[model samples]
Target chain A: MRNITLSKAVNEALAEEMRLDSTVILMGEDVAEAGTPFKVTSGLVEEFGTTRVIDTPISEPGFTGLAVGAAMTGLRPVVDIMFGDFLFLIMDQLCNQAAKTHYMSGGKLTVPMVVRTNMGATRRSAAQHSQSLHALVAHIPGIKVAMPSSAYEAKGLMKTAIRDNNPVIIFEDKLMYQDKAPVPEQEYLIPFGAAHILREGSDITLVATSSMVQVAQAAALHLAEQGVSAEVIDPRTIAPLDEETILTSVKKTSRAIVIDEGHQSYGVTAEIAARIAEKAFYHLDAPVQRLGAMDVPIPFSPALEDLTVPTPDDVVARALMAMRGELFHAL
Target chain B: MAKPAQKNSDAYLHMYRQMVKIRVFEDSANELYLTAKMPGLTHMYSGQEAVAVGICEALETRDKITSTHRGHGHCVAKGANFKQMFCELLGKDEGYCHGKGGSMHIADQANGNLGANAIVGGSAGIATGAALTAKTLGTGDVAVCFFGDGALGQGLLYECMNMAALWDLPVIYACENNLYGEYTHVSEMAAGALMDRASAFGIEGHEVDGQDVLAVNELSQQLVARARNGEGPFFMLLNTYRYHGHHVGDINRAYYRSKEEETFWKETRDPITNFGDWLVTEKLASFDELQALHAEIKTEAKAAVNYALSAAYPAVEDVTEHVFAETV
Candidate 1:
């Protein structure tokens, strides 16, 4: 095992995949020379050459559509969107073309492509750059959505997404790119829809995604000191959601709280909470609580921005409410 | 410009057959829609047959082409079966997309047809990307992007053309300037000349008489050869017109265009009639032979429509299929 940052894990995955398959190519703004603004693809051009590591003009719709067409033809293209918020610029390619090609062609064509983008708000990049829009893509069918929590999960999920035959979007938490964790030296792959159980407890289940996994884990530790045993579940992929694991965990705990960075209404947290309420209605001891970012746009002020998204304290408070059964009447 | 030696009779006959096939197929589709035999909307490829047939004649089976919403001509020109196309229009199970994509999304990937895009300039990037794939893989294949004049204002098309020229990718941007961008005149929507769009990117651009199938074919040969030889992308503006309305439901076009203007082109500039006249005048085939070919194609189109009408709709359970190549 080797300790590496999440960004390094992503770079390793791209390098290993390009080494394994000649068809794997990378394209994005400054992805080849400058390795993106985040520097995730910094040294890829040296190892893979410019042919495989392509730096495209700063046109999101143009390059995104080109990547879709490239995937349809022969190459397996991994397009870096630079920022997850820029997805709105390329929605026509992502949502309409890439996501619907396989189905629209009646299974005659497959778009084996990966769109690597970053999300989260801690860097104070303001509203446009700090939004987490995974739910917008998760709502669309045919496209798979993956969000990695740690360096290990990032490496595994990135490899799996690169090899998948359909269009897959992997949203890496920009705030967690520098976070280090132990990853296996050899190759590994984490399949889609498999939720990882970080910790097991009996009081309640904390269903988290992306960077919220760390937040939920910290909250679980805080709850443990107060005699509350909270189980933490990290759903790696949001589209092919691990409903089985979530349902089973909710049944075991009889209470659940969903934590996400996206907005609270009509978002990933709301979807998960609604599913738990519908599927595990009789198994619940209290209402399923959802803790997510506020409905307001992410502000530039540090204080306002920090308060917009849920913190470890917020998860702990929600878990405590679920455990005390006070959440039942509030819902 | 010097005229080349007389072409082979077989080549002219093939071009005539292709144009006739597109015309007959589109006429049958219009009839089907009017008679309520077919469901959904359709954009006819009438009057623009020579452009699709002529340009496609220059392409090899392995060379790719991306098409627009009015794509039946491109699909037929790219060698798609008329029976399957009818099945698609009728929303039958044997269709290309199993009744899912309908008219606007017919694709034959195996035949190097990269599907028809409903968006105006949507397929330009796809064609450019396919050229990039060919260049990277050393496939020696060229891609043609077939869009209408309406797409001239799209920024994505310019972006794609800029990249293709910068990288010297093997792509052909075939713009069929049919005088209008849907309801509005092309003059109102576009600024300066259409060919200037390509010249601004340092790519060579040309204009062709869209009604003259032989003219389009002759120019396409040079452009396709240039791309295949790694000479980079080329743009061609095919000056053409659509005899029918933009779509099947857009029959009353008097609000947008004058009847006299439409009749002037229909009588003098009809691609099939002009090509038929040329075939006779050049002694390539007698008028009787051309008539016999048209009759045969009409029968074939009728048979395809009958087959599609008899074909079943996709099963209700199969509606969920093809959502992914491999289900997760």
Candidate 2:
């Protein structure tokens, strides 16, 4: 019955987990008293004290590597990388050490840790700060990747990631931090690999992830006004993807379009679209389409930046093409 | 300053045995490579046995340690036997990591050895984090990070040391200055004085003759005890050497290092021979007794190699197993 912001949902999930388990620690730059640049971890240090909600230096690799070791021990660390662009700085610790520790150790050691980061474009933060790089991490085998679509998804997913036995990476769209959505007061968890079919239709499926879920939803509404019905689905976590849900929906609809904010080249859209084409080849009327961020460094200018990521109009136009069967060209 | 403890012949004999085990293990591993039986090459820990055995002897079975690519010595010193280690080196299922990880990534968690990192100075954070866990959980446990002079080139080590100093975590950053960073001499690799790296962060620094087991052990014991008391995050510089070429296949070394330098360290400053002579002079072990112990260790190492060579390889279906701790 109550609505909360996505950032607050993340903070609440961390606070609840920290209260439930003493070993759950929060470590990051400006995470303690400053509460992070987005204030997502605000009031955590006040309640859990400095030891639990740690304030680390500007050492990305340093603290990330430390989190790997701490997780192998008794502690469950939730490490915050302020921006997803900095994930490159911690590839060795995150991909090499944390991701592979469980397998490398033959299951003798487990790194039950969460790397919380924000990714999205159109912030006008330029190439250095704004980039949705979740597809890169999802390529790695050992890590689980989560993309929360709303405040409700954020709270449930954050709790699940903290308790996971292997390394997990949760990507939140920085632009959606303050976006409010209805969430339950009681404790709940959203299991990974489960797809949420937001709205059902028979003609076509508009499957998307993270912030793009809202785009698919808006496009579905616009398509309805234009006498076209579209189904909307969100694969909450990309790593343990609910392939069955997406495939079953595509099989019923006979047409699909996968949308994500990651780069279009070798990106999340390509992977999802390829999977649909491979599995649903017999059922498809027109080829499955992909709408993702353009394959270029995110620009700084607002006008230029807005052109990179896909929009609802882009989805609607693609849907109209599928309905008209124009997507099938000479190729 | 660490005060040397009153001597007991039993302690000397135990350390002597550990050092011999490492040496014999390395020698056998080298033979495994020469015969083309092992799958991949290995970084030998032969000459630096004292540095590992000395520090590990000062630790309890519960204390944790993060080792380097050159890690067999640390593994053996931290209570790992010959069979699992040889199996791991040979990439067999009975190995410590079930054959998934070879020499460069052997991790024996049951013995509190977290794992050996292939990256230089990579385990600094892991060791420090273990110390953080000990402090947070009140476990009274300490962590040792064993790296070589090459690790001095990594900035992560400095970051971990700075944080360790800030938190007063019980961790010892032990740098075995074996005078070479892979192939480059330490003089060319390191920028300034090595001990200054610790003092810049206000961490207590200590140096020891790594060839002498008692001296290195005495200091490690003092540091480990002090760390347990919450006065740690110390730094140790163990003046040591690596006898083999960087790896087993690196035999030609006329360009980087001369044969004389290698022979000098082997003959004059060999840790095992020096310690065995000290034990004989102190009347703790007879010369005949030391020779018999050496022979016994050699036989044990050879037997382990044979077992590992005969061990089964993991099934191909199991390749996907353990990628995740559990399916979620």
Candidate 3:
């Protein structure tokens, strides 16, 4: 295993896939010459040439729709949306066209494409630039949603998403791009719907996604010092959710705290919490607690932005509440 | 005034048969919808028969075309089976989309039809992308984007046009300028000349009489040849009108257009009548032969309706199937 940053891992995955398959092409605004603002595709153009690594004009719906058509016809296009917040601009293409083509065509067509974008707040990019909207796409039926927690997960999940026969949206946390993890030098793949248990414990279960996995792990470590054994589970993909892993973990602990960076109301946290409440109700010692971003839009100010999303401390506090049987009363 | 050349007689006959087939099929569909035999909405392609036939005639079986809401004409012109298309409109198990997509989303990939997009300007990018695929794969295939005048106002069209021109992709942007964007006239929505929009993107653009099938077919041949030869994208604005309303429910269109205007186009410049008249005048086919062909198409359309009506509905347990590719 070799240590690499999450951004490098994503770049490596694109490079590897492009090398393996000549049909694979990359397109986005500033993805070629500039490698995107985040530099996720910095050296792709040099390696694959401009034809394969394209820099499109700033039209989200246009290029996104173009990618959908390309996928349907012949090419496997990996579209890099500069920001996840811009998904709203291409919802018609992504949700309506790309997501519906396979079913709409009666199993006659398949869009083997990947739309890679970054999600999360706290970069001071403000409301439009900083937002975790994975839940919006996870709600879509035809498309698959992947959220990788570490460099290893990022590389493995991206490779898997590219090979998959349907449209897959990979939401990378911009804040975690610089974070490093041990990724294997050889090829590997992490299948969708399989949740990874980051830390093992029996007292309580903490379910997190994307950057929230780090927060959950930090909280678990803090809980361990205080004689609380907390289990941290990261569901790499939200759409094909690892229900069995989550339910089994919840059954063992009998208490669960769902963590996500998206809005608390009608978001990923609520969806997972509702599932646990319905399927694992009798196994639970207390109601599933959810800690997500505040209902308001992510503010521009550092202090306000920090307050909006769930912090490690917030996860620890929620875990403590669940352990002490005080979460219901505290609410 | 002049006879069609003996060499091109067969091609003209084929084009005429396809156009008549589309008209008869659409007329049958209207009857089914009015009589409550078919469920859901339909955007019929009644008057714009020549546009679909003209452009599709220039394409080979391997070439791809993306269509719009009023798309049955395109499907038929691209060689789709009338029986299967009828089955899809009726929402039967034997339909192209297994009865799930209904009218707005009918697609037949085998015939090189990408899809019929319900959203305005939705297929522009898809068609352009198919061109990109063709160019990348070294395939001689060309992609045709069939949109209406309404789609001209959509930003996605401009975006794709600019890219197709920039990349020199093998695509033909065939705009069926039916003179209206649903309820609003194209004059109110589009700014400057429609062809000028293509020139701004550095692509060659042309305007043709949509009612003249031969004129459209002549231009489509040039454009398709240019695209196949790696000469870049070509944009053509086919000036046409829809004899029917925007949809079947839009039977009464006095609110947006005039009866005189509709009558003038239908009476003087109806695409099918003009082409049929040309066929008779040119001695390519006698008047009796043309009438016989129409009868034959009508019978075929009627048989399709019967087939669709008798076809089974998809099973209840299979409702959620095909949501994703089975392999995925």
Candidate 4:
């Protein structure tokens, strides 16, 4: 095993796929010349040249729609939207066209395209630049959403997404890019609906995703001082969620805490909480605790911003309260 | 320009048959819609036969075309099955899209007909992308996108043109300037000239008389050949018009267009009658031969109607069948 950053893992995955298939092409705002906005595609332009590693104008709907057309015509194009917020401008291509092409074509054609966009906040980039809207995409049926928390999962899940016949949306968080993880040197791919158990304990289960995976680990370490063992689980993919892993952990630990970076109102955290209450209700000793961003616009001030998003301390406090059933009266 | 062969006489007659086939198809579809035989909205391609036939006749079998709402002529010229096309209009199971896609969405990927879009300028990007695929895969195929003058103002069209010109993609943008963009006149809605839009993207463009099939056909042959040879994209604006309302059930006339302009276009600028007259004067076909061809088309259209009426609807259980293939 070799330790690598998330950026190098993505670079290796793309390089391997490009080597395997000659028809694969990459296009985005700065994918060719300036590398990527996040530097994920640092040296691809020099390796593949300008033809295959294409640099496109700042036309999201245009380039994204073009990727859909190219995919339908026997070429698999991987498109990178500069930021997740800009995806709103091209919703017509994504929601109306790409998502419905195969269904409307009546199985005559397949749209084998991949869209990569960066998610979450870094250094107080403020409201428009920083947002986690994975829930909005998960609402649609045709696309698969991959939210990997480590370098190993990032490379493995991307290979699976590229080989899949359907459209896939891979959301990467900015904060998770520099995290270190040991990935295998040989070729490997992670299945779409599988989850990874990071830590094993018997007291409580902490189910998190993306950047919150680190936060969950920190919370588990903090809870160890009080003699409360915590188990951490990461549902690597959000759309076809691995509910079995989360449910099994909750059943053994008899409690759960969902740490999400998105808004608290009707988001992925709510979905996971609802599923656990429906299936593993009898095994739980208390109600599920959901720790997520506050229901407000992200502030520019660092002091105000720290209070909105969930921290490791917040996760630990919520987990200890739910473990003891102290926050609720009836429970 | 390439020489029109001694077989040009027979080819001219065959071209007339294609034009009349499209004219009769649109005419019969209009009549069927009046009798409530077809569902959804219908945009008949009544007067614009020369643009579709002239352009498609110049394309090789490996070439592809993208169409718009007024797409019956392009569909016929590209050799889409008439029986399946009518079945699609009738919403039958044997339709091009298994009855899921109606008139505006009929597509046969096997025939290289990419599909007709209902959105004003949606096909531009798709056609451009297909051209990009052809270049990347080293396939010697060219793509043509047919849109009205109304689509010239869309931002996506400009984006597609700039990208195609920058990459030297094998594409031909055939703009059918039918004078009217829905109810509004093109002079009012469109800005600048058509050739200026092409030049802005560094592409060679031409303005042709769309009523003359020979002129449009000659221009298309040169342009399509240039594209196939990897000389980059071409833009041609066909000055044409529509004989009917924007769509079926649109009878209000006094709102945007005057009756005099409509009558002038109907009498003088009719592409089908112009081509038929040329075929007769040039000794390509006699009057009886042309009349017999029209009667045969009517009979063929009648059989198509019968076939569409008898075809079955798609089963309800298969709604979620083709969302994704079983394997990559």
Given the true complex, what DockQ would model 3 score?
0.84
> Across all candidates, what is each one's fraction of true contacts kept?
0.67, 0.73, 0.84, 0.53
Question: DockQ for each of the predicted structures, in order?
Answer: 0.74, 0.78, 0.84, 0.55
Q: Model 1, range B64-159, lDDT digits (tens) per residue?
A: 999999999999999998999999999899998888888899998878898999888998888998999999999999999999999998988988
- Flag the better candidate by TM-score, 3 or 4: 3
How high is the CA lDDT of each candidate model? 0.92, 0.93, 0.92, 0.85
Output the lDDT of residue A158, model 3: 97
A121-235: candidate 3 lDDT, tens digit per residue = 9999899998899999989899999999999999999999999889999999999899999999999999998999999899999999999999999999999999999999999
**Candidate 3 i-RMS:** 0.9
Measure candidate 2: CA RMSD: 1.5
TM-score against native, each model: 0.98, 0.98, 0.98, 0.92
Q: Candidate 3, B180: how far from true, in Å?
A: 1.7
Give a tens-digit lDDT track for model 1, residues A133-173: 99999999999999999999999999999999999999999
For model 1, the stretches where C-alpha displacement exceeds 4 angstroms are: A327-331, B1-6
What tens-digit string does per-residue lDDT give for candidate 2 at A1-331?
A: 7999999999999999999999999999999999999999999999999999899989999999889889988999999999999999999899889989888887799999999999999988999899999999999989999999999999999999999998999999999999999999999999999999999999999999999999999999999999888999999999999999999999999999999999999999999999999999999999999899998999999989999999999999989989998945642
lDDT of 3 by residue, B191-237 (tens): 89888999999999999998888888888888899889999799998
What is the Å distance of residue A185 in model 3 from its true position? Answer: 0.8
Candidate 4, B86-205: lDDT as tens digits: 988887778887777688877778877877888888888788888999899878888999999889888888888888998899999999999888888899988777789999989999
**Poorest 10 consecutive residues of model 2 chain B by lDDT?**
B1-10
Among all windows of 10 consecutive residues in model 4 chain A, the one with the lowest summed lDDT is A322-331
The prediction achieving the highest DockQ against the true structure is 3
As for candidate 2, its clashing pairs are: none
